[model samples]
Target: MKTQNQFQLFKERRFLPYFFVQFFGALNDNIFKNALLTLIAFGAFNQETRELLTNLGALLFILPFFLFSALAGQLADKYKKAHIIRYIKFVEILIMGCATIAFWHHQLALLFVILFFMGSHSAFFAPVKYSILPQYLERDELVGGNGLVEMGTFVAILLGTILGILLIRIHTSTLFISIAIMLTAVLGFMTSLWIPNQKTISNPDLKINWEPFSQTWYVLKRAASQRTIFLTILGISWFWFFGSVIITQLYNYNQDILHGNEAVMILMISILSIGIGLGSLSCEKLSRHKVEIGLVPFGSIGLTLITIDLSFAHGLYPEQVINVSTFLSHWEGWHILIDLFFFGIFGGLYSVPLYVLLQSRTEEKERSQMIAANSVLNALFMVVASLFSIALLTLGLSIPQLFLVIGFCNLAVTMYLYKLLPEFLMRFIAWLLINCIYRVKITGIENIPEEGPAIITCNHVSLVDPIVVMASCHRPIRFVMDHQIFKIPLLKFVFQTAGCIPVASEKENPEIKERAFALVKEALDRGELIGLFPEGSLTSNGNIQQFRKGLERILNNNPVPVVPMAVQGLWGSFFSRRYGKAMLHWPRQFLFSKIGLQITKPIPPEEFNLEELKNITQNLRGDWE
Candidate 1:
């Protein structure tokens, strides 16, 4: 199978139409929102009142998500998502039309009401928008699809904000701004009409729970039942909170800190949005077209470091910069912009994997509800971010200092999460090991079952074979390794996090050997994959060794399918025994040596010949080692 580039998704109907619908919808939203803010800023009002109304506008917009996301999730679960998208888009057109009248009449109350309704439109659309992708696209396509969606959204928001702010500055700004938002809404509805209907509702029997509070709690509880899913939700919410703080402060940061005008604000927004878009799109390639959570930790680290850099990027410049030119002229201003851009890039890396993981792992029936729950948490976090910023700024923290706090807070939260759930960190280590040490080429990867219990039998060629295989497979596997390998100082933490099974010979440690077998049975019973290297020890001369009877014992008890895998090209590498002892090496091949993993079709339980299994592995690894 070929890996599809994320951009290729735009050529298809299932993705392209919805992508436009989202793009136009988000564009309209920001156009109206920014237009309102621009009015408040330049209107005849004091700074305090302007700030109050601006914050109020934000609150009103977010209120509907908290109030209506549960109902939206239920609607998505019980009804076809395409129909729901159409309804939401239709509502958006009406809301934007009414918003146009409000803009013309300068009716603050009506516009605020429309803003709440617009938020409701987005809230209702959120669950359906995401949950429908897996229904239409293949499992491998999900990462690319999500990346495109996220990248499109940020770009639309950037363009919308720039247009909103620029147009609202004109003398007859009302007509132009009104036309833009109204047209975008109409276009969004038209595009939504082209979205194909889902085959059926995910949970047709799932009753609609109208009460937001109780329904919200109910959905959240169901979603939280799975620890990893719940933590993934938290990770996504944290990203929103961090983003909210950064984007919210950009206005003031441009004016007060950077001493620049609205145009400079546009530049900052542009750079940040572009960075996120690139980062989001990069996820598909970086993850090798799979749902790799390692990118999450990598992304979080990038976000924290970049934001810290932004906090310290402040300067004691005395000039009153007027536009983008003056702003870009100073190295300090460029420093800030560069930070914002990279902040976006890492933010993209951080968020896209999480959304993919959430969508792919959740059950089809409860997927929308879980997404709704995520939406609820996201809104709550964003609200708290606004309040958090307000509180900090009021407590005499400069905006740059606020960014500093946001960075450290992100670091603290991610570290806590990694402790609670180490999969993110574990995957990060494996990804790093694979990328740095070897270029792994996997063949017949499709032969690996997508689910259920299975036994993986591979020839152990190196000390890091488990990590290499773990990184290649999409699902997590509880690898069975020699107890001695577990004692390695640098890798012990990762091994523990991954729940690796350590086995010793019965003579060396009977208790550990017995416990290893028990754990193997337990893991298989729970429908988990268990990895075993049946040769019993690493080959010193790069040759397959005699098969161990342990494989026979495990299969007898469990009767699970046995998959044969061959790991090649590590014979003389640093992790192989060709250099004295493994890891005590001088020189070998160049870094990133080609490592081939050939996994054959699984053998049925009745055909339980250990010699045949070894022969198949040898064939797959022929002439390589």
Candidate 2:
């Protein structure tokens, strides 16, 4: 059993510096923006000028991505990312210095220009920020790495925004705010110096395109070549869009429908931020470190339902105006708070998997570019969301109504995407079943190799075997499944998203057999683990089948270690032969069933003989046969 302390992940150099850099960046961004927005909101500027300034501030922030994102992607691919990030931080310090001056002089135009420069810095940093994760961490750590980043970013945002608002009351705190922002930038720059230099993967011979918008489309089109990757990016963009809309609306909703003040607004933001932080942390526990995206759909559903409930809870606007203190006395405010919390929880679920997917699937050379593209899309979506909000308001929709409409739209869009790719939903179901119904106890799991290419040969006794391995294995495994099983109603989607490899005998599908062999070789070359069941199909009579030749091909070509494993006491379960069909009946005490996985010590590739390996695996199964 891994103890709670064992999960403290920040000790690794690959993660720590990046974590702090991101943390401080988020902190500085929100602090400056919120302080500026708060000043505008509280009538520091005349009401007529405040709205224009606020609108201009938002436009300046988003415009950089539209103009510079492609160049940012090119730069990230052309140079060492750590160096790029370091320079970006230096730029941030300069921009913050400018912001401090603006704050001192009370120059709104100057502050807005500084905000645009900050956005420019962020546009360039965005790609390197996400693209660096896969370069440093192992595949299994991707989920945890992303979770920490997400949690840290949001926590920083929460603190920055809250502090910005609170500091405004001090009246003489401008110098302190300026100093803090500059220090944050300096600290982030120092941390960037520690980021290991990552090699660029794009074609150096490629010419740079001058036209930004056209180049952006070209980059996006390239990403579109991979259907799953494209959809994943779209999903990520939508999440940002949805988040910006709800958060912006929550501000107005709290002020109007909930009749709350700035403190209540901050409370709403804090709850949502904390909820996401908690949800992001939960992924490590729920997924056991694998990038299980099934949670995305589950989170999306909760976000949709809770958002609608918040809308319904809004009720008719009260004729009597209420202050923040009085609003806290009402039940409706509490309900809205609850809804925001869940919305954030689901938001975390929705975003983390998309990050993992991008890291795992995108090509190394193009990774930063892909991430840059995602950032651009996110910015674009935010712009669209802003427009949507303004349009809805013009249509005489209240903030609460706008929330309901967008929330419903979010649900509709999510459903459409999930229907197109059922794997997202299917993986969620499989993940839920494993987490809820089974408390898997893995024995000899340490016997699995810690590094390098390896084959995990196990018996195929149940439909859930791959998922079980996925849940328990400390490293990522590309399992070879029977070709037909890949077509199983919802199982196909789960398998696809999980990146399972489908295989068949030469007698079954010669082309697929060759393709599977090539994929195994490729994965091995990349030092990834590939799992295969030597028993070509699930046991028909609750006994091991003859070992097949595919294992020999994998071992001979890859020349990697082999770890033999056995799944005990699963042959008669719902998915096994005793049930006669997959999940035909639920066992009365299903949750109590003691399924076991025993892993044998790794056999070096040089010592691995086909017949000998089969015997070793057979022995591990013991009396289960």
Candidate 3:
């Protein structure tokens, strides 16, 4: 099914009300937290007490995610998510009401108590916010849905923070801030009332553990049971850690490096947030509304590069405080802003897909627990990140130096993840090639099985046939490519990481050919998908070459179902020989060139034959040649 733009989701009732509820929830949280921080910072407390209170306030908010997330996950799993959200929002109204009294009477202790409750509110809401999406959206809508949620979250945060800062500067700061928080909470509760109810995925009769420590352990153990899910959780945590480090240091980065005042700080934050919003929105377009892990590496790489650039981009301006307008007047200011913008853009790219992956891959019954686990780890990582930043600064590392270290560390961490899950790297390459070079449209993708062994045979029309097929298919596919093409320097890494089988003609390397067949059989026997081009090589003429016997050999040995797919519009692509030699002549269009892929029903191994497979693929190609 064709995907609607992420924005279009707002027009539908299923998503719009939920979006407003979440938006207002985040908005209120930031408004209250930032106002409290600002009050403590500029209020009448002594330097020691003020600093202690400020830090404690931040810690107070994060503490609940650690202590209450297990229970929160349990409730979300056990109850209808939308209903839970309404109850949570009602609690938020009560909490904000208490906050109003606290702020009105200037009761610091009471305000601190309210802060903890607010954190608790967020902790409970976290699991429900993410896990409910799968119940609300289609599998294909996960990416776009997540992107919109993330974008909305950050944008709301930005606006909330701005409002907090502006409102807190008023003469009756406390009263104004209190009114704002209470109003937002009431609005959030009203929005929650409009959210449609969704069925809980967890067992209704499932036992609930009331002990926080034991329940947290139980949830953590469950998360660790699934290796892929656990790694994805870790990936999400690392991104939080990485992003937090940069954000925490930005205040210092602005003061010490950019030598900017408050307005300049806001300007930098606006650029960063806008960049993230844009990058998050772009993920759906890039992934074709699919959960594409390829963007994870792509995003991580860009984040690292941009961070390194930011590290260098600083220290160029004069060490004198300037307002946003004055800072913008300088060329050096634009440089710094550009780096900040891209840093956020890449950060968004790195994060949204993994969130979608976590949502889509986990079983419905346990999904909330998985999200709670993610929140717990995310909090841990952020705490560690705070300590790391302090340690780095204590070591006399400059802010720019800190960024440089983070950049290199990101490179190391992503490489490790790529090593851990080569599928992520495979999808990254395929996503990059398809998005950058060609516009690929996939049809009949449902023909591929959602699980179990299947051999997908496509006519080899271009060098990039495997990539296009990989990007389109929901499941990861091990491709069988010519040994020489597999050995090509840059392309080799992609193929090897994707676990592609390298084959040679029997006359050239019979041993390697035999091993390739063995790998294909092994993959099939394991119920994994394997892709092959029956033509053995890319077509020299824009016509289907005679089918090879390799498919016959594989089906005979493993007898897995065979899926025949065809690439139609690639005959004249730059990767194809319809021009001169592929890639040698550069006379074709650069971007948005149309390409098409069509898949036929899976042929049972007993019914599969070389001639029949070839005919179906050719017919699917039709007039595109």
Measured by lDDT, the strongest candidate is 1
Summarize candidate 1's per-residue lDDT along 22-122 as a digit string, tens digits: 99988888888888877776678765566567667777888788788889999998989999899899888888889889888989789889889989989
What is the C-alpha lDDT profile of model 2 across 48-96, one tens digit per residue? 3544455556667877886778778877776777778888989899899
- Number of residue pairs clashing in candidate 3, backbone atoms closer than 3 angstroms, sequence gap of 3 or more or interchain: 1
Cα-lDDT of candidate 1: 0.88
Clashing pairs in 1: none
Work out the TM-score per prediction.
Answer: 0.97, 0.83, 0.89
The residue ranges of model 1 lying beyond 4 angstroms of the native Cα positions read 1-3, 44-50, 319-321, 587-590
Q: After aligning candidate 2 to the native by TM-score, how far in Å is the CA of 501 from where it should be?
A: 9.4
User: Number of clashes in every candidate structure?
Assistant: 0, 2, 1
Expressed as tens digits, the lDDT of each residue in 1-625 for candidate 3 is 3246777788877888999999999999988876776677556775445534655676678778989999999888888888889999999999998988887887888888988999999999999999988888878788888888889988988888777766877878877898899899999999898998764446466678999999999989999999999999999999988887897677557766777765776677788888998899999988877788988998999998998888887646776677888888877789989998998899889999999999988988888989999999987887777668767776778889999999899899988987888788888778877777778778888788878999999988887888889888767899999998898786788788788999999999999999998998888889999999989988999889999887887877888899998987887777788888877777565687888899989999888778988899889999896
State in Å the error of residue 367, model 2.
Answer: 1.8
Sort the predicted structures by TM-score, highest score first: 1, 3, 2
Q: In terms of lDDT, which candidate is stronger, 2 or 3? A: 3
Looking at model 2, residue 363 earns an lDDT score of 85
